[model samples]
Each structure stands twice: as structure tokens, then as C-alpha cells.
Target chain A: MENIALLMHGFAIAFSLENMAAAIFGAVAGLIIGAMPGLGGITGVSLLLPLTFGMNPTTAIIALAGLYYSTMYGGAFSAILLNIPGDSPAIVTSLDGYKLTQKGLPGKALNASTVSSFIGGTIGIIILTISGPLLAEAGLAFGAPELALLVLFALTSIGWLLGDDIPAGLLATAIGLMFATIGVDPALGQTRFSFGQINLLSGVSFIPLVVGFFGFSQVIDMIISGEDGAVATKVRIRDCVPTGKEIKMMLPVSIREGIIGTFVGVMPGAGATTSAFLSYIIEKRINKHRDEIGTGSMIGVAAPESSNNAAAAGAFAPLLTLGIPGGATTAVLLGGLMMWGLQPGPLLFTEQPDFVWSLIASMYIGNVICLILAFICIPILVRAISVSKKVLVPIIIAVCVIASYANSNAMFDVVLMLICGILGYLMKLADVPTTPMLLTFVLAPMLEQYVRQSFDMTRGNPSIFFRGGICWFFIVLILLVSFSPLIKNFYLKMKDKKAN
Target chain B: MGYVLPGLSVLMGLYWAVKAFGYRLWVLNGPGGGLFPLIAGILAIIFGVVMIMRRYRTKKKSDFSVKSIFPVVSVIGIIIASYIIGLIPSLGVFIIAWMVFYEKEPWLKSTAVGIGTALVFYLVFDLWLAVPLPMGLFELI
Candidate 1:
């Protein structure tokens, strides 16, 4: 009941004029950015983050959060119309979405995707509203050791799950950790790796690093991939309306996937992409019209679309409650929270109820706003998908330079951004996933602080890390995640031997 | 690219480990500044070694070409030009050049986009955000 009262208060905050405008602007911008190929939530947020430098923290977060989930709605635009996924999560959507386009039912696919995104996003927000505070309350019991173990669990899981090559992922994780150690040491206040440069004193800036990694590397990719303009397909708004039976068929699937996606989002390392893939696989197995899944079925469009949006919402649970980012986009948002000087953790709920609750409350509004904007702007958005990559490539490069410079008004940061961008491109060329690196970069400093605190508490007793149930629980999970690859290989070999 | 990346990782691990040792690894039983970096360095070395070994066993042919470095070179040119002219002007020139020369767009349209984008950026970053973007030779003038 008290939580409900707080939620009402949150609604009041979200209803404020500034916040309302932020949400609307974010929705429009997110839709356009999401509809563009090769740009995802991470790049979109990184580009827009600098614009919010002077805004109130709550308003800034509200705007970014609005942008984050609306991308899920917008991503379906390109996938349904042009056969190119606007984002990674929407790759599954394109399988049936483009097939539907081929069958002259692009309108139906778009409508199904939009409706399912809304349903899944709404359900996810409800779960977050219920679970966020509960999770925060539970987190209050954790000590330094448990916190350290939990961070380690998150890092190891990300390293294990992000790429096909485990060694490559581990290398990325190590590199991120090493990067975090560049500035003054968190514990002893001793500078570790400054190499005498003054800019190195404060460490590498997050904005420049992120802009370089996600934005600038993308520019490089666009330039290299060569330009191909999407052929515009006309779909009138009237053509976008779905039948009652179609809505009914999508509703149950959306609800089920939404529920599942929320839980998946709450888990460390598993993100919207995973959630969407899992939902589609499950839908393939169980749907009444299973055979029609890849044959332009509405259920195919709904299943992944709904789950990805739900997972986007679900990702916030861990981020708000435990200060742990569930995925790469949330990791970037976590960095934003820190940049805003708002510490995200259990205390965030008690310390800043207005901030936490308002952000949560805004999600519901953002979902509705996204849905309406998606429907009304379909014609324009389809055109946006056709915008020339030649034009986009140069504009993104300029934005990257400006964003990196705007961070601290230093040209050095711009140079750093370029370096990181090149590095990011090289990493991609080597098939090394950069997501774990970004996640680790954000979490490594926090892990250092917790580990040091634990060591200080126990006078460097290694046993301190194994003291409590929470610590042990995290330890067990970390070990299991770390060795699961080996276990799987062994099991596969045994099965093959048996078959022989 | 495959061999280069793992080899770079190995070298970086070596450098990091040596630099980390300069800081005390421990202070009175508690971890000092060097401990975490040392751990990271060691992990990097282990992972890099494994990656290199796997690459060696596979002996996969590298598909890398010098062509991919063109974007990097172009951006570096822009950075150098930014120092000579200004960030806004250099970016405007980059847009015009890329569109006109690379995309083969009409001069009128490319110029309009170039100047228009630069103008918007100036208004936002300078007038609104007050970011004090680099003026370069403009500052000297």
C-alpha cells in the first residue's frame, strides 16, 4: 500500500512539464534512431547523453530511459519494412517481419510488433514496480564481501556468456579491468598508471570511451560496408490496423513472453537479445500456429518483439536495486547514473524515492508515448530507414567528435575517442565481443571498492570472502558459470561416445 | 588481425604486470594498489596465451586488408585539420568532401547539408550548451 502511494507520487513527478517534454522528445528521437540500421540503444543513448548535461538528474534519466525502451518499438520499423534489423534484438523480428512484407502484409507485421512491444513493455514495468523495491530491500542485507562476490559473479557471467570464444571474452574483461586501474587507486589514493600525463590523472573519461566504442566504430563500419539505400515501401496508417482475432492471438503470446523476458532481463549477462531469441524459440515449439511462424505469421512478429521490450524493462530491476547493469545498454545507463552523481544501489530507493519512483513511473508513460508515436509516424519512419548511409556516416562522425569533446571540452578526449574507436573496430574484426569490456569497465571500479572494503574489514583474511551465505551463493554461481563450457564439452563427448 | 590482437594482448599484459609491480602489491596484509592490476595482467596473459595457442592450432588464413584502415586515416586527417582550422569548420568540410567526392552528390545539396549540420552543431554546443569547442586558428585571429 505504501509502495502504491509512492508510485502515485512518482506519477506526479513524471507528469511535470519538463519531464513530460523530455519523454516526448526521447520517444521521437529514439524512434528515428532505432529505425536506422546499425544504430542500437547503446549508440543512441551515448549520442544523446551529452545533451542532458545541464538538466536535472531525474529529467535526464527520464529522457534516456524513454529513449532506451522506445528503441524496441522503433527497431521493428526497419525489420518489417526493409529486411534489415534496426538493432540486435530485432534480428529475430526480421525473419518473419520481412517475410510478411514480401506477402504484402507489412502493415500487419508492423501493427503486431507495435502492440506486442506495448504489452510486453507494460507487463515488464509492472513487474519492475513490484520487484525493484523488494530487490533493493533484500540487497540491504549484503556486506562488502557479498557485494564483491556478487560483482564478480556478474563479471564472470558476462565474460562467459557474451561471445563464442571464452578466451577472447576473458581478454576483454581483463582489458576493461586494467583500464579501470589507470587513475588514482580507489583504496590507497595512489596513482597507478598515469604515465605522467595530466589527463591520465583522472583516468579515461567514460563518455569519450563509450562514444568511441559504440559511435565512432559504427561510423568506421558504415564507411567500410559501403552505402545501400533502403527501398521505401508505402504503408498507409489505415493499413496498419489489426483484426480483433489477430490481437487475441498476439495477446497471450505477448503476456507469456513478457513475463519470461522480465525474469531473463533480471538475470546477469542475459539481455534483450537473449530474451527475444528464447521467446521466439519457445513460441516455435508451443504456438498453435507453429508451422506458420516463419511464414509471415503475426505470432512470429509478436513473440520476439514483446519479449525484447519486456527484457528492456526487466533490465532496470537489477540496475536500480543493486547498482548492477544487466546488459550493455544498462551498463551505459549505469555509467550515466554515476555521471549524474546519483549512486544506484539499495540506498537509492530510500535516499531518492522521487528519482527511483519517477523513473519507474515514466516507463509506463514512455511505453504509451512510444506506441502512439510509432503508429502515427510509421510513414515518416519508413522513409527514415531509407536515408542514405553516405549522409549518415559523416553526420555520425561529426557527432562522435563533438560528443567526445563536449565531455570535458578537451581535444585529448577526442583523440582518446578515436583510439578507442579504432580499437573497437579491431576487436570486432577479431570477432571479440566488446559488450563484456564495456560491462566490466563500468563494474570493475565498484568491485575494487567492495573488495578493498572487505579486505580492510577482515585484515586481509581470504576467508572473509567465504563467510556469509550470500557470498557463498555468488561464489557457487561464479564457479558454475566459469566452468560450464568445460562441463558442456565433457557431456557432449560422453553422448557421442555412447552413440558410437 | 587474429594473430595481431592476441599478440597485442600478450604484450599489453606484460607491460601492465611490470608497471603494476612498481606499486606495492600489499600493505600490512590488505591489498595495495598493485594487486588488482596484477591479477588483471596475469589473466590477460593467460587468456592471450590460450587465444594464441588456439589460433596456432587452427592456422586459419587471415582476411585482413589495408583497405579497412582508410576510415582511420580519414578521421586522423579530420583531427589534424581540426587543429589547423576549427572543429566545426573541419567537420563541415569533411561532410562536404565526403558527400561531394565520395557519394558524388550535387555540390548544392552537399554544401547545404554540410553548412546546415555545422550551423546546428554550433548553435547547440556553443550557444546553448556553452561547451567552448576548440576555435583553433579562429582563436588566434
Candidate 2:
């Protein structure tokens, strides 16, 4: 009964004229941006984050929520029409999505993809609505030690999952954590690495860093490694609707993948790409038409499309409940919320119940908006994909420069953003994962505060971290997550040796 | 190129680690401000050293491609331009230069894009969002 009342109140807030307008605008803009290759949810969200500065946190988040889900939906358009995937999550979608397009069922493939994306997104949001509050409620029981351990677990998981090169990932994470330690210590008021610079005293600004990391770095990439222009396929509105038999065939598999996607999304560091690929593999194993997965199979198109969208929603679970971002996109969202002076996690639920619930309500509305807009806007969306790099690149640079300065009204931050952008480009060159670094930068201060608090309470006894069963559980969880890659590698090596 | 950045990072990390050690690491009751930083600096140094060692062992090619310099130069150009003439004019100038020289667009089109972009930025930042962007000489106007 309480849940229903809160939900209704949330609907009242989300359905406001301004909030509704923001949601629609965000969905359309996100769809347009996400269809462009090399710019997906993270870039779209990061680029648009500055616009949210003047708005209320609820209104800000509702728009961002729309952008977040619709970006995932929009990513499929390019993957199906062009052989190119818009983002990592769309890579699997392209395998069969493009194949189907090649086979002259472009309309059939697109319709199935759109319907499945909506189904998956709807399931994920429903689960998030119910599960998010429960998770946050459970988290209200945690103390500093548990929170600190949770951050540690998240960091390690990010280092493991986000890294293709483990050592470099670990190095990037270490560097990021060190960067977070600069400026005055929140607990002790003693400056560590500010070097007496006034600007450095406030610590690194989040927006500048994010803009440098995602926005500036991408511009650098586009310049250095020139990319081919986008090639778009034409689609007719008449062919956009799937047949009844096709819908029936796709429904069960889409639901299964949606469930799989939600579960994968709820895990820290597990993202849409992982969920989509895992569901694709699982579908091939369980379904009798396994051989047809990559060969223009409708089942193949439905499976990954559904999973990726669901995973995008699932990725929100940890972000809202525990203040831990599950992937890069959510990490950007967490930063945006923080910029608005709104902290995510359990306290946010109690303190800003309206903000939290309204954002959730907006997600439900945003999904429907995405379903409708994604279909209605296909012709326009396809045209958006073919924007040339020459025009876009210089424009991006100008925007980055403007946005960085606007964030703090300081030229020093513009310089700082540029420096970080250069470093980000270097890190990419070295094959170091940027996600670990980004997340660690966000989490390090919180982790430090918790560690210090726990130690103070226990009078320097480290064992206080383990006194609680939850903290111990996190400790074990971190251990498993950190070493699992090594264990897997060893197991694989042994199997290879046995076969030899 | 691969080892250059990591080597520099190692030196910086060690310098900070020593500097951080001068502060109170553990204040009798609990860990102090310098404690986490000192640990972090030391870890950074270790990671840097590991990165350097791995680079040496792998014998990875660290050739500096001329292609990479184009973007860096472009970024530096924008920064210098923005600093000298103010942000809006500098943006207009930079876009024109980028489109004409690098992208090989026609002068007319580049000028149009440059002017249009500047106008849009003016309306959006100054008019709509009210962001006080650096106007340089334009501020006098």
C-alpha cells in the first residue's frame, strides 16, 4: 500500500509538464546521438550532463533516465542498418542484425529488434522498481565498514571486468585512486597533493574530468585515427511492423533474454555488452535452432537486442541503491547526480524519496516513449547516422571547450580538462582500461572516508572491518572477484595441457 | 613512448610518496590524512614500475607516429587561440582552420560553419543558459 502511494506520488511528479517535456526531448536527442558510431550512452550522457546543472535533481534525472535507456535502444539501429555497431553492446546485434538486413528482411529485423528492446526494457524497469527499493532498504542497515568494503569490491570487479590488459587496468585504477587523494582531506582537513594551488584545493572537478575522459579523448581519437563515414540503409514505414507469427516466435526468447539481462546488469562491472553476449551464447546452447544464430536468424536478433536493453536498466540497480555504478554509463550518471548535490544510495531514498521515485516513474514513461519514438523517428534517425566526421569533429571540440569552461566558469578548468583528455588518449594508446580509472576516481574518496571512520571507531583495530557478517561477506566476495581471472586462466591452461 | 609516461609517473609517485610521509600517517587513535595518500602514492609507484618492466619484457613497439601529433597540435592550437582572442572568436578561427586545412573543405563552407557555430554558441551559452564564457576582446564590445 505504501509502495503504491509512493509510486502514484512519483507519477504525479514525473507527469508534470516540464518533466514530461524534458523526458521526450532527452529520448529523441539520445536516440539521434546514440545512432552515431563512436558516440553511445556514455558520451551522450556526458555531453548532455552540463545542461542538467540548473534543473532540480528530479527533473535532471528524469531526462537523463530517458537518455540512458533510449541510447541503448538507438544503438541497434546502426548495427542493423550498417555493419558497424554503434557501441560495444551493439556488436552482437550487428552479427545477426546486419545479416538479416543483407538478406532483404531489413524491416522484419528492425521490427523484431524494436519490439524486443521494449519488452526487455519494460521487464528490467519493473524489476528495478521492486528490487531497487528493497536493495536500498537492506542497505540502510550497513555502516561505514560495509560501505567501504562494498566500494573495494566494486573497484576490484571493475579492474577485473573492464580490463583486457589486467596490469594496465590495475595501474590506471591505482593512478585514479591517487588522483582522488589530492586537495584537502575531507576527514582531517590537511592537504595532501594540492601544491598550494587554489584551484587544486577543491580537488579535481568531476565535470571537467568526465568531459576530458569521454568527450575530449574521443575528439582526439577521431582526429588521430580518421574513421570512415557512416553508410545508412533505407527503410520503409510499411515494413517496420513485424508479422503476428514473427512476434509470437520472438516473444518467449525475448522474455528469457530480458530476465538474463536484468540479472547480469545488477552485477557491478557487468554491462549491456556482457549481458547481450551471454544471452546470445546461452540461447545458442538451449534452442534447437542453435546453428541459425549468426546466419540472419530472427531469434538471434531478438536475443541480444532484448538482453542489452534489459542490462541497461539492470545497470541502474546498484547505482541507485548502493551508490556504486555498474558500468561506464552509470558511472557518468552517478557523477551527474553528485554534481547536483544529490548523493545516490540508501540515504537518498529516505531523504529524497520524491526525487528517487519520480526518476523511477520517468523510466517507465521513458521506455514507452522510446518504443514509440524509436519507431516513428526511424527515417530521421537513419539520416542522423551519416553526419561526416569533418563537421562533427570540429564541432565536438568547440562544445567540449565551451562545456568545460561553463562547468566552473574558470579557464583553469578548461586547461585541466584538456590535460586530462591528453592523458586519457595516452592511456588508451597503452591499452589501459579507462572505466576502472573513472570509477575508482569517483569511489576513492568515499572509500577513504569509510576506512578512516571504521578505524577511528575501532581505535586502529583493522579487524573491526570483519566483525560484521556483511563486511566479511564483502571481503570474501572481493577475494573471489580479484582472483577469479587468474583461476580461470589457470584452469584453461590445465585443460589445454591435458588435451595436449 | 610506452615507457616514457610510466617512467615519469614512477618518479612523480616516489616524490609524492616521500612528501606525504612527512605528515602524520597515523594519529594514535586512527589512520591520519596522509596515511591513505602515502599508501596510494606508493602503490602508484609500484604500478608504474610494473608497467615499465612489462613494457621492457614485451619489447613492445613504442614508435611515435606522426599521425598522433595532428590531434594534439589541433587541441593546442584551440587552447592558444582561445587564450589570446577570447573563446568565441578563437572557436570561430579554430573551426575555420580545422575545416579548411585539415578536412579540405571549401573556404566558403568552412566560413559558414565557423560563423554559424559561433552564433549558436553565443545564443546558447550567453542567451539561453547564461554561462559567462570567456569573451576576450569581445568583452570590451
Among all candidates shown, the one with the greatest TM-score: 1
Worst 10 residues of 1 chain A by lDDT: A226-235
lDDT of 1 by residue, A1-500 (tens): 77788889999999999999999988888887677544568867987898898899999999999999998998888667655466767767876887786565677888899999999999999988887756434435566787678667756656433545777888888878878888988677888788787887888777677667666775566566553422334445576688899999999999999998887677655678767866776787578988888778999999999999999998898898888887778998999999999999878989999999999999999999999998887655544434567676677677777777776777888888888888777777666666567667766876888888888998888899988787788888888878878998999999999999
Per-candidate DockQ versus the true complex?
0.51, 0.43
Summing lDDT over every window of 10 consecutive residues in candidate 2 chain B, give the lowest-scoring window.
B62-71
lDDT, residue A117, candidate 2? 94
Clashing pairs in 2: none
lDDT value, candidate 1, whole model: 0.80
Q: What's the DockQ of model 1?
A: 0.51
In candidate 1, position B121 carries an lDDT of: 83
Binned by DockQ into CAPRI classes (incorrect, acceptable, medium, high), candidate 1 is: medium
Candidate 1 collision pairs: none
Overall local distance difference test of candidate 2: 0.76
